[model samples]
Target chain A: MRSKTRRAALAVLSAGTLLLAAACGGDDSSEADESTITWWHNSNNEPGKGYYEQVAKDFEADHPGVDVQVSAMAHEDMVDKLAAAFQSGDLPDVYMERGGGELADHVEAGLVRDLSDDAADEVEKIGGSVAGWQVDDKTYALPFSLGVVGFWYNKEQFEQAGITELPITMDDLYDVIDKLKAADLTPLSVGAGDKWPAAHYWYAAALRSCPEEVLTDAVGSLDFSDDCFERAGDVVEELIETEPFNAGFLSTPAQEGATSASGLLATGKVAMEMQGHWEPGVMQGLTDDGKGLGDKTGWFPFPEVDGGEGDPAAQLGGGDAWAVPEGSPDVAVDLVRYLLSDEVQTGFAENDMGLPTNPAATGAVSDPALAQLLEVRDAAPFVQLYFDTAFGESVGGAMNDEIALMFAGKASPDDVVSATQQAADEEK
Target chain B: MTRGGWRQRLEILLFVTPALALLGVFVVWPIASAVRMSFYRWKGFGPMEDFVGLRNYDRVLGDDVFRDAVAHNVVIVVASIVVQLPLGLAIAMLLNRKIRLRGLLRTIVFVPYVMAEVIAGVIWFQLLQPRYGVVDGIISAVGLTPPEQGFLGTPELALPTLFVVLTWKYLGLAVLLFLAGLQGVPDELYEAAQLDGAGWWQTQVRVALPLLGPTIRTWLFLSMIGSLQQFDMVWVLTGGGPANATTTMATYLINQGTQRHNYGIAGAASVVLFLVSFVMALAYQLLILRRDTVTQE
Candidate 1:
C-alpha cells in the first residue's frame, strides 16, 4: 500500500513537469515567427542605460517590422551567460566584443562572425580597424568609442593645497601626497573596494612604465614575471606605502563612479582620482553630494614616471565594439549596419557619454570635456587594449588577485610577478 | 473472479509505471549523462569534442587547484564539527532556562540565518571596512593596526575568517535543532541524575547526551554536507580571492565548468566531489547512526 501511494504521487509530479515543458515549446514557435533580435550588453550606468533605451526606441521606429530584445547584463555575467546560451543553441544575436586575446579565443572557438570580408568598407569607415580590434586581417568587432583611463582631479583642490603642477613621476606623486596629508585631505580617493580598481593600479602603472614588447611576450606565453610585472608591482608598493589611497579603501568595495573616488573628488574631499573619462557624467547630478567642488571639473594625462616607457599622453582604455554572433540570420548583418549608421552613432554621442565609433560623428561631438579626451587619444603612442581584454580570463583573474594584495601593501612586486607566472603555469 | 484479480494487478502496474519512468528521466538519466560527459573532452559551448575515457578524471586528480579546493573543504567541515557543534549546544542549553524574554532572544538569535547570504556578506564587508568602519577604526585608534595583512586578502586568514562568518550564519539553526533534541530527552533521566547528586555539567554529559545521540549524528551529517557545498558568501565577499586562497571545491568546479566553460574537466571534478561526499555521508550513517540503532535494539 505504501509503494502504491508513492507511485500515484510520482505520476502526478511527472505529469505537471511535462505540461510545463510542452507550454514552453509552444511559446518558442510563436516567438520564432516574429522578427526578434536579442542583444547582450553590460552598460548599466545611468547615461549608458538611458542611451541604449533611446536607441532601442529609435531603432524600432526606423526598422518598422523588426523587434529588438536587449538582454543586458554585467561584464562578468555576460561571459558565463553567453557560454551557457551558446551551448544550448540559444545565443543572443548580438553582444559586445573584446579584442586582442579575447578576440583570438573567440575566433579560435569559431564563435565570431568574422566581419572582415563584409565589414571591410565599414572597417575603414571607423578608423582602419583600431589596432586593438583587429586579429591579423579579420575584424570581429566595430570600435564605437575610444577611451583612456586618467586621473580626474579638481583644479580648486590642487590650488588650495598649494600644488602648482600635476605630479610627473613617482617622487612628484609622493610630494603631492605629503602636501595633501599636511592639508588634512585624502591624497587619492581610490576605493580598493572592488578588486578591479585595485588591479588598475597594477596594470595601468605597468602600462605607464613596462615596455610594449614585454606585454606582447607575456600575452603569447601567459607568463607574468616579465619585467613589466615587476615594475607594476613596485609602483603599487610605492602607492601603498604613502597612505595615498583613501581610508578604508581595502574594505570598502567600489560601486559606481559617483559613489567611489570620483564622488569624493567631486565633493572636494580629495584632489584627484585614478579613473577613465567615465567619471564626469557619473558625478554631474550627485544626490550624495560632498562639499566645496563647484562647476570646475577636469582631467589630465597620467604622469610620466622615470623608468616608464609609456607616453604621458597615451590613453589607458579601449572602446566598446558591436559584433554579431556566428549563425545569426542575414537580418543581423543589416541590423549591425543600421546600429552603426552615421545618424545613430552621432545620436548616441549627443544623447549619451557616446564617443563615436563612426568617423562621420567626429565633428558632431561638441562636448568640450569629450573633445579634450579625444585629443589625448589622438596624441597617445598606443592606447593599450585594457589588459584584461588583451589577456584571457584566467590571466586576468590571477593578475587582479595579486594586484589587490599589492595595493594593500601585503605583497611585493617580486611576489606579484612570481604569483602571476605560477598562475600562468597552472592555466597551461 | 480470477479475471477480476488480473485486472486489479494490471491497474496497479499502470499506476507504478509513471513513477518508474520519472525516476529514469529525472534521476537516473541525468546521473548517467553526467557520468558519460565526464569521459569526454568538451568545453561548455565550443564545437570541438573528443571522447577520451578516464582522461578527464586523470586531469582532475592531477591538478593542484583541485587538491587545494578539497583541502579547503575539509577545513570547513572540521571547523563546523569542532566549533559550531559545541557552541550551538551550549547556546541551546542556556536558552532552555526560564529567563525574561527567552522567546524574543531565540528569535533574535536566529535572525542571521534568515538573512540572505548576499545581504549578510555585503553588510559584513562594510562593517569590516578598514578606515571608516567602526570596528577597524576603533582597532586602529588604540595604536594597533588592524593586523599587518588585509584580513580578507591574506591567504592564511581568508578561509578561516569565512568559516567564522559561516558559523555565525548557521549556528542559529544548529541551536534550534539541538533545542528540539534536548526537549526529546525525558525529564526522568535528569531527575534521576539530580537525585544522584550530579552537577550540571555531569548531568549533561552522563544523562542528557546519551539520549541526544541521534540529534548529534543528524546535525553532524547536515553541517558537514552544507559546509562542503558552501558557495554564496565566499562568492559575494571575497570572490575566492588573493590568488584562489578561499576557493572551495564546489566554487572551483562551478567556476571551471560554468564560468570558464571547461565542461569536461568540471564534470570530472564534480564526479570526484560526488564520490567523496557520498562516502562521507555513508560513513556517518554507518559509524555514527546505524551503530546507535543496532545498540538501541
Candidate 2:
C-alpha cells in the first residue's frame, strides 16, 4: 500500500512537471526570417469580401517577408471577438474597422496604435477627408467606404401615383406616402425586423435638431436625453401615422423585411424605401434584371423637418476603415503607405465599395450612383458617424433601447428625451 | 502500531487532495476574482481600476432598466410555475403511458431540449419574421394577418413573445424530469389500489402523485433556478428591446458589465442575483429535504 502511494505521487509529479514546462515555454516571437501578421476582417459579402481578400494577398506578395493572414467575421460577430481579444490583450496586428470613433473604446483601453503622423502625411494624397477616422488631433482608423441613408423611391410607382417629383420636405413626403397608399401601394418600405434599421428613425430625427457640436458631444458622452431625442419619436409617429410601411411590417423579422422591402420596391408595390447606396446591391440580390424596381429609381436626401438645423446637405452616414493594433509588428507608417498607395486606392474605387479616402482614386470608379454619392460626400458640411460607435457601449445602450421604444410606438418623441436623460443621469 | 489505520488515513488524504485542488482551481478561484473585481471600476480591458465599493451596486439599483430587468425575472419565475410546470407534468404523464410509438414520441418531444439556444432562437426568429416568413405567409393565406405589427417589434409583445419562446425551449427539460419521477413510482402500489377499487385518477392522486412528491419538488427547484438565469434568447431576440421590456437579470448584468465596460456595476448586479438565487435554492432544498426525511421516517 505504501509502495502504491509513492508510485501515485510520482506519477502526479511527472504530469505537473510536463504541464509546467509547456505553460512556461517561450513564444519564440523573435524567430528570424518571415513574419506572420494576423489581420482580422468582418467583410462577409461577395465582391466586397473578394476585393479585400485579393488586396491582402497582393500586399503579402509585394512584401516577401511579411505574411498577412486574414480572418473574416460577421459585423456584430467581430465586435464580440474584438472585445474578447481586447480583454485577453492579444489583439491581431491589423483588423477591419467600422468607421467613426468606434475604435474609441479600444483607444481608451490603450489597445489601438495611433496613426496620427501617418494620417497627416496621407491626408495630402487623400484630400480633405477627415470625416471617418480622426479622433482629436490623431487618426486611428482610415476611411474605407461611405454610406448615406435616404429615400430610394420607385420612380414608376411615383409616376403612376401622379407625383412628378420626390418629396423634399416632411409635409411633402408624408403627403406622397398618403398618395401612394391611396393608389393601393405600400407607401414606403422600412425593415423594422432588424431593430437597428427600425431604430434608425430616432437617430434620423435627433440629427435634425441636435446641433452638430451637441450631437457630437452627446454621442461622446452617451448622454441620452429627452430634449434632443424628442424629435425622433415625433417623426417616427408622424411617419407611422401615414401608413408608409407595408401591410405587415411589424410582424416581419429583419431578414424577411429585407426580402419584402426589396420585393415590394422592385415590383412597384411600394413607392419608396428608406435606404442607402447599397439599395442597388440589395436590388440585385432580389431581381435577375438588376434594373431594380424601376429604371428611374433614384435617391433623395432625407427631407428637412420644421425648424431643424440640418440642411439637405447635412447627412448622417459613416463607413468602414482600417487600423493596426498596437501589438502589430509591422511599422504603422509602411502599412498606411502601402494601404493608401494610388494603386491600392484605385483598386478600392474600382470595386465600387464606396467613395475612396484617397483623392487620387477619382476616375477609377465608374458607377454613376456611387459617383453621385461621392459628389454628396464632397458637398456635405457635416458627416455624422453612427451613434453606436460614438459612445461607449453602456451609454450607447440607452440610445439603442430608447430608439427601439420610439419605433415600436411605446415611447413618443418626448419619451426619447426622458429616456436619454435618464441614461445620461445613470451614466454620470 | 496498527499499519492499517495509518494507511487508511493516507488513502483518504490522497483521494481528497485531487478534488480539493480541482475545486480550488475551477470554482473558488473564479468566484474569488469576481468578488474582488466587483469592488473596482474598470472596463474589462483597461489596466486601471478605480476602487469604488458599493457604488456599483448603487448605480445598478438606480438604473431603471436594471429595476425593470429584476421585475422581468420575477415575471418569468411566475410564468414557469403557473404554466411551464403544469404543461411539463402533463407531457411527462403522457410519456409514462404504454402508448404506441412512445419511443418516437419521446425522442421528438425531447429533441428541442438539446438544441442550442442560438439555433433555436434563429429558427423561431425565421418562423416569426414578418415580411417573408413562412408562418406569416400562411397566416396571410388564411385571411388572418399574423400582425402588420412585428410581434417582437412592439413593446407590448416583446416580453410575452420571449416568455413563449422560453416556455417552448424549456418544456422539454421539465417533461424529462417529470417522466423520471413517474417511472420510479411503484406499479404494485397502483395495482394494489386498483384491487381495492380505486379509479385511475384516484390511484394517481392517492398513490402515484403522492409518491412523486420528491421528484416534483426537485424538478420545480431546478426549473425555477434555470428560468432565473435566462439570458441568451432575450439577447438574441429583442436585445432587451422595445424599451427594455424583455431585459432580464443576466442580460442586464452582461450589458452593464461587459458591453458598457462597467465591470463594477455588472459585478454588483451579479452579486445581487447570485445572493437572491442562492438563498431561494437553499430554502427550497431545506423545505423539500425536510419533507423527504419526514416521509422516510
Candidate 3:
C-alpha cells in the first residue's frame, strides 16, 4: 500500500517536471528565432492572400536572414485574435490596424511602435491618409488603402426607374427614393441590425451639415454640442420618414449572406446600398455566379445636405493600415514601409483588392466602378473617418444604439445627440 | 495514523488534486478576476489601474438597456415554467403510452435538444426572415398577414417570437425528463389505481403526478436557469435588437464587454447576473428542493 502511494507521488512529480520542461522548451524555441517577423493580415481569400505571400517572399529575398511569417486570417477572426493579443501583450510583430480611436487606445497603452521616424518617406507619400493613424502628430501606422464610403447603386435599376442622373443633394436623393418607390422597388437597404451600417447615414449627414473643423475637433474633444450635430440626426430622421429602406431593414445584417443589406443590393432586391469600397467584393461573394451586380454596378457619393456648412465634396470613409507592435524588430518597420511602397501598392490596386493610398497606384485600379470611386475619393477635400471608429466603441456604440432606436421610431433626433453626449461624457 | 490510513490519505489526495486544480484554474480564478475587474474602469486591455469602486455596478443598474435585459430574463424564466410544465407533462404522458413506433416518436421529439444550438439558431434565422422566409410564406399561405417587418424585426413581436423559438428548442428536454419520471413510477401503483376504478385521467393525476414531483421540480430548476443564461439564440436571431427589445442579461453583458470594449461594465453586469442566479438557485434549493433531499435522506 505504501509502495502504491510512493508510485503515485512519483508519477505526479514526473508529470509536473515534464510539463515544466515542455513550457521552457516552447519559450526557448520562440526566442531562438530573432530574425522572425510575424505578420497577420485579413486577406485570407484569393489573389490578395497570394499577393501578400509573394510580397513576404520578395522581402525575404531582399533582406536575407530576416524571415517574414505571414498569417492570413478572415477579417473578423483577425480582429478577435488581435484583441486577445492586445490583452495578453503578446501580439504579432506586424498586423493590420483599423486606425482612429482603436489605434489611439493601442498607442496609449504603448502597444504600437511609433513609425514616424522609421517609415517617414512612406508616411510622407501616404500624406493626409495617415491622419487616421496619427496620435499627437506622431504617425504609428502606414495606411496602404484609404477608400471613401459612397452609395453603391445598380445602374440597370436606376435606368429602369428613369433616374437619368445621380442624386447630388438631399432633396434629389428623396426624389430618387420617390421615383424608385413609384417603380415598385425598394430604394435602399441599411443593415440597422448591425447598427453601424445604419449609423453611417448619420455620419454622412453630419459630414454634410457640420464644418470640417468642428467635425475634426469633435474627434479630439468628444463634443457634440454644435447644433449641426443635431441637424445631422434631423437629416437621418427626415430620410427615415421617406421609408426608402428594404423591408425589415431594422433586422437586416450588414454583409452576411444573400439576405443582408449588401446582399439585397447585390441580388437587385434593392436599388442601392451605402457601403465602403469593399462593396463590390462583398456583393460578388453573395451572388450565385459570383458576378455580383457585375458591370451594372454604379458609384455615387452621399449627397449634400440643404443649408449645410460643410464641403459637399468631403466624403465619409475609413480604411486599414499596417502597424508594427511595440518591441517589434526595426525590420518590421522596413516591411511596413515596403508594403506602402509605390510598386507594392500599385500591385495591390491592380488586383482590385482596395483603393490604394499611393498616388502612383491610383491609376492602377482595374475595376471601372472602383476607378470611379477612386476619382471621387481623390477629388474630395477630405475623407472623414467613420464616426464609430473615430469615437471608439463605447461612445460609438451608444450613438449607434440611439440611431437604431430612431430607425425603429422609438428615439427622437434630440435623444440621439443626448445619448451620444452622455456616453462621451462617461469617456471624459 | 496507521500506515494503511496514511496510504489511503495519499490515495485520496492523488485522485482529487487534478479535479480541484482544474476547478481552481478555470472556475474559481475567473470568478475572482471578474470580481476584481468589476471594481475598475478597464477597457478590456492595458493595465487594470483605474479602480472605480461600484461605479461600474452603478452604471449597469442605471442603464435602461440593462434593466430591460433583466426584465426579459425574468419574463423568459417565468414563462418557460408556466408554458412548458403542462405542455411538457401532456406530451410526456402521451409518449409514455405503448403507442406504435414509440422509439421513432421519442427520437423525433428529442431531435431538437440533440441538435447544436448554433445550427438550430441559423436554420431558424433563415426560416424567420421577413418577406421571403419559410415562416412568412407559411403564414401568408394560411391567409394571415405576417407583420410587415416579419416576426423578429418588429420590436413588439421580437421578444415573443424569441420566446416561441426558445420553447420549440427546449420543450423536448422537459418532455424527456417528465417521461423519465413517469417511467420511474411503480407499475403496481397504476394497477392498484385501476382496481380502485379510477379513470385514466384520475390515475395520472392522483398516482403519477404526485410521484413525479421531484422530477418536475428538478426540470423547473433546469429550465429557469437555462432561460436566465440564454445568449446564443438571442444573439444569432435578433442580436438583442429591433431596438434592444429582446436583450437578455447574458446578451447585454456580451454587448457591453466585447462589442463596446467596456470590460468593467461587463464585469459588473456579469457579477449581477451571477448574484441573481445564485440567490434564486439557493432559495430554490433551500425552500423547494430541500423537501426532495429530506425525503431521500
**Top lDDT prediction, candidate number:** 3
Q: Could you tell me how far off, in angstroms, the CA of residue A235 lies in candidate 1 after the best superposition?
A: 3.8
Model 1: per-residue Cα lDDT over B66-118, one tens digit each: 78888888999998999988899898888876789999989987999999988
CAPRI category for model 2: acceptable
Ranking by DockQ: 3, 2, 1
Clashing pairs in 3: none
**Candidate 2, B271: how far from true, in Å?**
2.6
Tens digits of lDDT, candidate 1, A316-337: 6877788777777656666677
Q: What is the TM-score of chain A in candidate 1?
A: 0.85
Give all candidates' CA lDDT scores.
0.72, 0.71, 0.91
What is the two-chain DockQ of model 2? 0.43
Q: Looking at every candidate separately, what fraction of the true A–B Cα contacts under 8 Å does it contain?
A: 0.22, 0.43, 0.63
Candidate 2 is scored at a TM of 0.87
Q: Chain B alone, TM-score of each model?
A: 0.88, 0.92, 0.98
Residue range B1-297, candidate 3, lDDT tens digits: 899899788788887776675676668889999999999998877899999999999999999999999999999999998899999999999999999999998888889988998899999999999998999999999999989998888999999999998998999999999999999999999999999999999999999999999999999899989999999999999999999999999999999999999999999999999999999999999999999999999
Winner of 2 and 3 under lDDT: 3
Query: Pick by DockQ: which candidate is best?
Result: 3
Candidate 1, pairs of clashing residues: A148-A316, A148-A317, A193-A252, A193-A253, A209-A308, A248-B131
